[model samples]
Target chain A: MQSKSNNSLIKVRQLTKRFDKLIAVNDISFEVFKGELFGFLGPNGAGKTTTINMLTGLARPDSGSIEISGLDCSKNPKLAQHLIGIVPDESNLYPELTGYDNLCFCASLYGMRKHEREERARDLLEKFGLSDAANRKFAGYSKGMKRKLTIAAGIIHRPEILFLDEPTTGIDVASARQIRQLIANLHDSGTTIFLTTHYIEEAERLCQRIGFIVQGKIVRIDTVISLLQPIQKKHTMVISVLHPDEGLHHKLISEFPEYSIELVSKGQFRIVSEKVINIGPLVRCIEETGGEVSEARRIRPSLEEVFVNITGIELNAMKKEKQKNGRSS
Target chain B: MKRWIAFWNILLKDMRAYYLKPPNISWGLIFPVAWTGMFFIKSGKGLDSIISLLPGVVAISILFGTTSMLAVTVTFEKKNKSFDRLLLAPIPLRLLMLAKTSGAILFGSINAFIPIIIASFLADISHVNWFALVLAAIMIAIASTFLGLFIAVSVSEVFEAQTFSNFFRFPMIFLCGLFFPITSLPIFLRPLSYVLPLTYGVDILRGAIDKGNIMPLWLDFLIILGFCVLLFAISLKNIHKRWIM
Candidate 1:
């Protein structure tokens, strides 16, 4: 969606981070152009946080080079720190400080003047819908409020580039939606954003270009449109049957040789094909095979399926992480 | 100029978040007074001995106050990952560390005066060298705060940092001639006393308050300054090797 401006703001070459015997980020190279919302998508332990830490100057890399806005930050990581903002996975702002104070403190770290920082902090608190809670201690705020304030603190200085690591991993749905909207507004305002998330749908909804990282390696990097192009040509449908016999799936597969069939459960199965399958024939075939079809619906292909196909990671694993994070929230 | 701004902000933030709290301020004031009273009664030293007890009390106050505050604050921030936010700042690492430890230094320097204030009420401190006392208190605070920083970065947990700090602190109290002369110690243990930063600090305080000088005032100040620089350098190196990596 025209995410690139042909002006690269971040460049990395053969970046690698090793912890003892484990290589967290291995030889990954990609450029994020100015004003682009680039997503780094991966499952848990896929080195998403590690990569963001290296880019944000939180952790030193074992090997490789990084350039932010044409400043070589390999040896001197703090050289480009003034131009970028970072929101870590967890809310790292001081719990003892009020929301307003946290923002002002972060602005001060970037060397903003006292009056300017105070005004900016107030503006951000209002914009983030946290004006009422601005005076409250951060530790007293809700999980969602804390996340919002952390994001506000990250942008307190109006940095040119922002790094958000799992911004909405363990937040309420409403907060997640609001955060996504805020990120979209930031991208629209021409701020280059490097967002790392495990939510495939979140990436598809917000990012222009997506980088799929698996086992510390970048498996694919392409625009959202380009990444979904191949999957879009295929039609998928999930059909639910009432008390289907064991042979029902075999019979359906034999009858529909052109479509790929997989038994999702005892009463559910999915059918995928290159061409759109006629619903009438599939229903008739199921009925003829002594299996009463309860529900059959065409499903749209999503980034989730593309991610699974590309990374060879089961969707169940990602879903488990989502559930775990949800329970914690 | 930008670096200085960041440095001041970091120091001010730490003050607001930790040092300026009413509870900590009270504790800082009360602890030194308690130590003074306890030691005075324990030694059965009358009013005449208050001046002699002043140097040890001041040194111990700075030592304990800086280490306790810094050990807890730094390790707690590291545990909660808040220190990572400071690490991402645009300031140099050395400057950032200085900003972080300066709060504890200021707290300790103020703490050193608590015993002096208490003694001034009971004994005549008019003869005391005020300049030397102030210099000794500040250098001791700096050296002790850096030692605390070193302990904090060397460990991952708050409790571990405290335990690590005590390994350096408890020995200094006895071996550094806090209440007694280093010559009274066995010859083998005398070398260990000089190795402790507080030994030089207490020696300076002794020269200032009691006119008891074992070494020249310049040598005492020089050695204490060297310890400050050395401790600060080592702490910064530990932060790079253990923390940033």
Candidate 2:
């Protein structure tokens, strides 16, 4: 019998992290493949950031093992760190230094030569569209500018793996889009990206595989397609008719038994079907029932719907739960 | 070589930040100069005695300036969490402590000369041995820098460091014979003054100034060197355990 595991670039086994009686990460085990865009999805206090901290050598795990690029993190932290680049949740940039200087400092910490560090700093600044603000001190930079520079700094050394915590939390739409594009570009260039974000849309767009963490445990991990499968199987279809047909709703349900239909008004009906492919059958049934099928289209469930279904609560509700837990304990 | 470069970077950064705001420099020099000036005005009996006392007084002022300034600055940095950046860096803890201590020492050495120059203009201290004064100033720098490192690592807050530094500074100023002769103190108190590191430092300076070798030069040097080594070891150990985390 062969072991069922692929070549893992980053493997975490039974990792546990606790903060003085509060268990932040509870024996979580996972593997990240080479050149894969993995999304670490969870509401706040789900141990995503704590796991990242342990992986990056900023904090020590209470037990278990973390191996990056086949090197054990506990045995050789510097070497493991060299293989990973991290953009922490908080902006850890040096406020006294300029945007260019912060990047150079990071490069130096990684033992890059002065001239090479300078060139890479300049290149990253231009790539992040921060060249114009390169000379400005970070203390004065806007939030978006600061976040962009931080991302540039993290990738300055071109580490094999990258960890981004909430890469686009409070930015304008255009800047968030640009950041998303940058991440996608990096992923294309063969960098394994591990990202944590509350933005479900970002995970839906970028992640090849995502893990859903709830209360310090990974509740689920799968491809975005698989996680949305249950929701996708049932789509809401809104239909409009030109004339009022009293028996149209009854006729439509009897004719298309696969679809569950509800009449909102004299000329409108709400249809929920088990498959998107059944939308055609439902439209034909509405027309056959002496009603004009106007604006009949399948509306698939969104990431929000999937999240709510899996977690059994909205994002705000989860946050309130976390806050209450924080206050009480 | 890498250690030296890291140390130089830290030292230069501190110097740049210190000079960026000139008030620190002005305040550091003002107190010592004012004290020297008052002593000159009060002591009209002998020009030679006043001249001989000038270097010791200046050395004492510099020692106080460097140690107290470093303690305050380090405590503030620690409290504000700015020191975490340096502590988390790849540089060794000892090198960081040495670099910060040396920066303050360098400033103290420079500020020590201001009072001597001012005194030279007011009193004819041309007869005093300038070579001895330089040596005494160098010793003062080493001793005070270590003392500052000890205080910086041991204390957790600026106000606490300041209060403790002031308590020690006042006694050293009077009892170490910065302004008056150690012989003027009572016999019981005189022995206590001898145990202080600043006492031998002041003796060396005064000996260098007056051309009167009262204590054995090598003995004084050895005692001061021993104090510096002890303070440095304690400071490095404490900083390594606390700051490295």
lDDT of 2 by residue, A84-135 (tens): 7887665667676789887876676566767988999999999989999999
Top candidate, metric TM-score: 1
Model 1 chain B: which ten-residue window has the lowest total lDDT?
A: B36-45
Q: Give the TM-score of candidate 2.
A: 0.72
A195 Cα displacement, candidate 2 (Å): 2.9
Off by over 4 Å in 1: A1-6, A327-329
Error of 1 at A32 (Å): 0.4
Off by over 4 Å in 2: A1-9, A75-84, A223-226, A236-313, A318-329, B1-7, B18-21, B38-89, B96-102, B120-245
What clash count does candidate 1 reach?
0
lDDT of each: 0.90, 0.76
How many Å off is the CA of A71 in candidate 2? 4.2
DockQ of prediction 2: 0.15
